[model samples]
Target: MHQILLIRHGEAAKSPTDADPGLTPLGQRQAETLADDLDRQFPGGEGVRLVSSPKTRARQTAIPVAGRWQARVDEQHNVIEIPSPEGMPLAERGQWIRTLLKSRWDTLSPAQGNWREDITDYLLQLASTRDEGRFHTTLVFCHFMVINSVVAAIRNDLQVVQFYPDYASQTHLAIDDGKLHLVQLGQETNIGSLIQ
Candidate 1:
C-alpha cells in the first residue's frame, strides 16, 4: 500500500495586508517539531516523498522535512487553500469560508461543486502506484480546507467541514487497488480565522 499523509501547514500570520502570509514564529517551531516527528518515523527519509501546496506557509512547512529526507518538495497547485471570490479581502475571507462550509457539497453552486471535484480528482490521481513491489509514502503539506476536502471525499460525506485539522496535523490514508482509503483522521479542533 502507498501511504498518503495529509499534513496541515503550521499556523500562518493572519494579515489582511499580506495576500500570502508566511508562517508565524510559533509556526516555525511547529514545523521543526513536525520534521523531527517525520524523521523519527522514516529515518533518513527513506521511502518518502514530500509534496506541498504552492503557498508560503505550506512551502515553509515542507522545507525541513524535505531537507531531512533529501528530497525536493513537489509543489501542487490543487493542494492550496480554497479560493475566495475575486477581490475578497483577507479579513473577510474567513466569513465567506464559514458560510461555504455550512452547506453540503451537493448543495453548492455549480462553480463551487466543480472546484471540489477538481481537488478530489487531483488527490485520487496522486494516490497511485505503478510498481506493485515497492511501497512508499507521500507527505502533503497543505491548508485546512484542502485536508478537509480530501477526507470528505474519501468518506463520501457531502459536508465540506468534515473536521478541523490543526497545524501540523497529519491525516493518514492508504492507496490500494486504485482506491484511496482513510487509515486515520488527523487531530482536529475548531480553530478560528478561516483564512488560514
Candidate 2:
C-alpha cells in the first residue's frame, strides 16, 4: 500500500509582489506547526518522500518537513496552481478567481493547457510511482485546486474535487491494490495547538 498525504500551502500575503508570493508570518508559523505534527505522526520518516509544486508557498511549506525527514524535496511542475494573469484591479481579480473556480478561462490556452495537463499528468505519475513501490508514504504540497483535482481523479469523484480546503489543511489516502481508499479529507491543522 502507498499512502499519499496532500497538503495545501499556508496562507499567502495579501499583495503578491514577487512572481510567486511566499507565505505570510502566520502562514510560516502554520507550516512549522504542521511539520511538528507530521513528525509526531511519522516518527522515523522512513519510506516517506516529499514532493511540492514550484510556487513559493508550497515550496516553503515542504522545505522544513523535508529537512526534518532527511529527504530531498522534488518540484513537479505538473502540481502547480492554476494560472491567473497579472495586473488586474482588486474587484476584477476577485471576480477572476471566481471564474477560475467555475472553470472559466483566462485565456483559452493557459486554462486548457496548464490546469488540465497538470492535474491528469500528476495523478498518472503518482499512480505509476506507487505501482513501482518507490515509497510507502508520499507528501505532496500544492495548491487547493491542484490537490483536489488529483484527489478527484484518483477517486473518480469530480464533484468533491472542486471544494477547496483551508490553508495548511491535509487529506490522506491509501492506495492498495491499485485503488484509492480515502482515509480523510480536509483535515484541519490547528496552529493554536502549537502555540499552546
Candidate 3:
C-alpha cells in the first residue's frame, strides 16, 4: 500500500499585492501543532517519507514535521500551488478566488495547458515508485488547488470541489495498486478534521 498524507499550507498573509505570501503568526503556530501531532501520531521509526510543494508557505509548513520525522522533503511539482487568475485588482483577490472556485475548472487536458506537464511528470514518477516498498508513509505539503487536483486525478472526474483546509490542516489518503483512498479530513473538529 502506498500511504499518502496531504497537508495544506498554514495561514498566509492576506495580501493580494504580494506575488507569494508567507505564513502568518497563527500559521506558524499551526505548523508547530501539526508537527507535535505527527510526532504523537507516528513516531520516527515509522519509515515515513515527507515531501512538500515548492511554494514558500507550503515548504515552511513541512519543515517542522519533516524535522520531527527525520525526513528530508522531496518537492513535487504536482503538489504546487493552484493557477492564479489573470490580472485583477489586489483588493479583489479574495473575492476573485471565490468567483473562480464557484466555476470549478476541475480537470484540464494535458494538450490545453490546463494541467502543468511538470506536475504530471512528477506524478508519474510517484506512481512508478508506488510498489517499491521503500517506505510505509508519505506526506505531501501542497496548496488547495493542488490537493483538489490530486483528488480529481484519483477520482478521474472533472467536477471541482472547493476545499478550504484551515492553516496547516491535513487530509489523509492512501494509494494501492494505482488507486487513491480517502482516510480522513482535518476539517472535522471533533476528530481534528478542520485543524486550522
For candidate 1, what is the lDDT?
A: 0.82
Q: Per-residue lDDT tens digits of candidate 3, residues 113-167?
A: 3554454445445545544767777777877666666665566656554355556
Per-candidate TM vs. native? 0.90, 0.77, 0.78
Candidate 3: residue 151 Cα off by (Å): 2.3
lDDT of 1 by residue, 1-196 (tens): 6788999998899876687889999889999999999999989887777888999999999988887777888898878877777677777876787788787777766766666677767767665546333438888899888887788888998888888888899999887777789999988856573457
Model 1, position 18, has a per-residue lDDT of 80
**Candidate number with greatest TM-score:** 1
Clashing pairs in 2: none
Which prediction has more favorable lDDT, 2 or 3? Answer: 2
Per-residue lDDT of model 2, residues 104-188, tens digit only: 2333455545675666555445666534665777788888777666666666654423455778888887777666667888764
Model 2 residue 112 CA deviation in Å: 3.2
Candidate number with the higher TM-score (1 or 3): 1
Which wins on lDDT, candidate 1 or candidate 3? Answer: 1
Instruction: Decide which is better by TM-score, 1 or 2.
Output: 1
Off by over 4 Å in 2: 85-94, 102-114, 127-134, 154-161, 177-181, 188-196
| List of clashing residue pairs for candidate 1 | none
Error of 2 at 138 (Å): 1.0
What are the lDDT figures for the candidates, one per model? 0.82, 0.70, 0.66
